[model samples]
Target chain A: MSETPGIPAPPEEPSEEQASRIGVDSWVAETERHGRGRGPLWQLARLWEYSPDPVKLLAFVALASTVPFWTNEGDLFVFGLFTLLYAALGLGLNVVVGFAGLLDLGYVAFFGIGAYTYAELSSSQYGIHWPAEATIPIAMAAAALVGVVLGFSARRLLGDYLAIVTLFLGQAFVFFTGVANPTVAGKGLTGGANGIPQLDPLTFFGYQLTSTKQLYFFLLIVVTLLATALYFANQSRTGRAWRALREDPLAAEVMSIPVNRLKILAFVFGAAVAGLCGTIYAAIETAAVSTNFSVSVLIIIYAVVILGGFGSIAGVFVGAIVINCTLEFLEPQNDHPEVKRWLFYGTIVLLIALLKPWFRPVLVLAGTIAFGFVVHAIVAATTAASWTSGVPVSGASWLARWAVIPTGSHGNFNNYLYIGLVVAVVCTASLKGWWRMIALVPTLYLTALVWENMLTQNGGITAFILFGAMLIGLMTVRPQGLLGTARVEIV
Target chain B: MTEAEITATEKAAPPAHPLLKLDSVDTYYGQIHILQGLNLEVQSGELVCLLGGNASGKSTTLKTILGIVQPRNGTVQFEGEDVTSRSTSYRIGKGIAIVPENRRLFGPMTVLENLEMGAYLHAGGAKEDFDRVYTLFPLLHERRRQLAGTLSGGEQQMVAMGRALMAKPRLLLMDEPSMGLAPILVERSFEIIKQVHESGVAMLIVEQNANVSLSIADRGYVLSTGRLVLEGPAAELREHEDLRKAYLGR
Candidate 1:
């Protein structure tokens, strides 16, 4: 009579019913004696749990907080600035989706609102100049107010309907900012496509945060303070209530947790955090562009939050660091293609090394190598040397003879190879053990061929490809992320 | 009283001025009607059982009374006050507690935390309630720090009962407490339920095993296909010919 579908009914299985027939207390005793999640990954999870939190936090802070000093401004901006920015953004999102169990697709709208409000107050576009202290608070308050209003209006809607409403609201925010920027005093208020620029730099107590290093330190400080505050808050009653609401809203409401009020409070907190990040973002870039807060960026933040482990404060940092660094690495390096090329080969090697059953990886590697050379030799012998003359990417010249990269008109000829490669990869996922291994041999070869031909030509497109691959890989491997505990849900 | 003694009673009417009442309740899940014109009542300090086969709207009645599901056209009253439109929490605050089906323990939380959650409205932190629960189910105290998910089915059931008791409710609602338990455990659990019932709280228990529930229940109601078909003292209902054919597997 229990509504939970996945719970095993006593009489459904003979063994269980027989166990129950023996005695009730013994069954419970037997269950306690048995192990849960008996696997290598679960063992690793145990080990992770045994490690102390402060020790891990200190190590992470040491690695992250010093990034601006060692790297160039470009690297610092790419790796340091954006990474921390996204971490803050991701943590904000974790509160709503992970803690409060609310599907707020309109989260980015608050972030956008924070940026626009700050820009309007501090930038030349509006001819207003509020100090950083005043502007940031006002922006955050405005965003929180918006979040409360949205939460109050949508109180009756739950789950999927809530998601749809927030999703539409997000789209409306984009349209209003990008195309529907109403004209005030004979000028477009939001600057339309160009966006509002010439924003004031972050100034504190008669000193200006002019350099990337200063901004990085400021951000590092803010992130640490916020993370600490969130940690304390999570230890309080509010966090427990939020988690209870997330687990089962109906149950929580009945248990006297005040579900609706808690949901709205979650939104307010999430919006405030997002608002802070948005103002800082505008300050860092000296601009607030509508294009900056597009749906893609929203997805990126969601991916980061999910990857780091929902509801985990530390996980968001880890997610942000991994994602932002990878995205930065894939940025167009016209003068230096070695980074992308090395990254591609390194990934393949890593996958091969991690392949299960030890010998299967060796076999797959040997097969891919043999398959490449045999085809290359046959192509060269049958046709011209120029037909198989193209080289491997970067300085890996020894690979040139075996890897068949067509010279001149390196065109849609490889398009078929790439398409086949996609199909082969997808097939490998769906195939069983032996068939998957068999498919992998061709899939590996095709991947190399595709990369050498099409993927290497444009870092822009490959960035997305790499992101998609990483997200899929993370979900399949560890949905809990770096520091999150695995949860069991009723089906 | 022994089974032999129970059969001696043929006429037992419910006490006047029942503590809770559902009048002509009609519930629907989108299109299909569930609890069709269902009327039921539980007297103050009485242990009542609602029995039915699957999809007979047994669980639906509990949900309706708890406000988890709203009846289309009916009134549910608690102590003479209409509670049909009240929120589930509001009803709970008014001395109603439910042991939701399958225990529904917050799996990640420790047994202690789960009990604490049951007393969420208790600002004084329910130390006395916790002690009372521990006294009733000492195994819960032994496994107070253990995660509810790791516990066996029977132990999880105990935790659920202990959790509901922590609310210190005047009325308790349990859905299939005997489910997934061995026969011996069911008897032991029923003993505990009898103790709780004797301690002056009214109870409304929903079950598929009519015989087991009716053994301890003061009175019984049989619901089939969203309607009550029989009602009487537990001793009389247990011997009812129609109930034996459909439920007792005789």
Candidate 2:
């Protein structure tokens, strides 16, 4: 390692003043240098770090407001509008999980409550057409009331127990709306699994938000207000109290902070924000469905929060944008099969490029391509003609020639290849140095084979699988998330 | 003692009522009893030390006084009010502060923020409190922006003392102030305790370092196995044979 010419030499016997001037101890300086990173991306991150909060918010809003002009109605609703909604919901969850250090798994129940409340009041199913202004506040209050009840019931529980109880609460919401839809005022309150449809658009004093563009703009305004409000809230006395309790509840309690009350406040505040987002989401979709509030939606919201960085107001928007856009781009309904295919391969290439020493990634990429051609030639020469005759999905003829795609039914050949791919991935990850590099050649080829044969057929599931992998990768690389400060645990 | 100094000390008599008092307190952790029918008190403007070895219920006594651990029976009176059932925050709000064991500083927070949390009850009027704390520990002011976790053990101890003082408590509960410090730092810490005591706030120092605690303390209580075995003036306890044998290594 010392023979490397580019690597800087270790410092020798520097004076105490010189060490202090560098702002780090001499022993860890090399590791610190590596961690700090370099190049344009790090410079950009530093710029972002130093910029004022309001300025960043203004810039984000300016960028987001132009979405309606560039995209059509469908794309705007799927990509632009949904991103804002999730950003709003993720911000609310951030309060409970990030600010107060509570793992509130049942947070989506509040979102469902808000949507259903709006549905009952403003939809034809209830025969009561209340204005948006009244229904939104009512929905928020109803959700906040339930939050208070849950917070009081679970006040004595901590950590895993709280997560369990909240998880049950979330499941209960889904079950009640879908299975045990109670009759209220001569109609099924939640309309069973079908839910309450044909909901009226948000009408503030007779100004209806009928068009998709209008709803998108309306949501943009709501998200901006919520983010700004939360930013200020994070700077206030209550914010400090919440952070104190998050760090050490016992210490905060002995320091004159009312822990239980502040905890309940966090629940109520987070629930109310989710409730507000629900009203707008209902307005945009023009319906309320039980399936919309399932555990899957909860997972997506959690993905947004975790990816964005906990306890950071700005991280929610960044996370929502990345997650929602990626999911939308991979959606089968979007009729963009080609885009998904390119994205899958592009991501693999990007990961390979990030490997250290530069030449490793280059070697692995070249070795995998050569190995794929060699395997294809051998398989074609040995196996039946039908075994090697297969076409690639989305018309990628080049990949079809290289990847082992079966032509006939092949009797679970895809399943076997997928299992083999998983094993190969595990082996590659466990090995090190040149052995790992040698192992990656087969793993990469197997991955391409599995993707071309099986994963492309189920685009939705493939999106989720890739999403999970991305989260694991991000967590391993930077557990602090994109915008959060790295915390030090004293124990 | 000098005749004139002894006369000066005698002329300044203690107030009528003690600032803090625990009357026959019994504290339990789950099923195990930690403090068994313990009685303790700290007079206003006095430095009282509670000396005990491991499992002697010394730390539990501090926790019980600060309301972190409530006694099963008997009352804890602060400023002559029965505060046994009050919450920890309520006790803190009523002017009972504690420098907890291990100096449980908020690791991720800045020194200034930790101090701010100590004065949480007196928010918006903590400018003078900051000045008072900075005056006592000037090093804290310089490192105010730095994270408390990054500070040296001695500096962390200073922050803990400054934090407890920020509450402006009438009676402070300190648990093992010299537990992790070097001998010289321990002496400096005891000196600061004396200085803080001279500023008129009462204190109850719980420690295993009986010799050092008793040197600056006005009164001392020795505990073993959840019971107080000795109680007297600090001068008398220093010369007590059993205390010297067990703690002072005479």
What does each candidate score in C-alpha RMSD?
Answer: 8.3, 5.9
- Reference-based lDDT, residue A268, model 1: 91
Regions of model 2 farther than 4 Å from truth: A1-31, A351-360, A385-388, A395-397, A419-446, B1-15, B182-184
The residue-by-residue lDDT of candidate 1 on A147-193, one tens digit each, is 99999988778999999988887888888889998998888988887
Best by lDDT: 2
DockQ of 2: 0.50
Question: Each predicted complex: what DockQ?
Answer: 0.25, 0.50
Write one digit per residue (lDDT tens) for candidate 2, span B63-109. 88888788999999987889999888788888888888888898888
Candidate 2 overall lDDT versus native: 0.85
* lDDT for each residue of candidate 2 in A152-237, tens digit (9 for 90 to 100): 99987899999999999999999999889999888999999999999999999999999889988898998999889889988887
Q: What local distance difference test score does each model get?
A: 0.81, 0.85
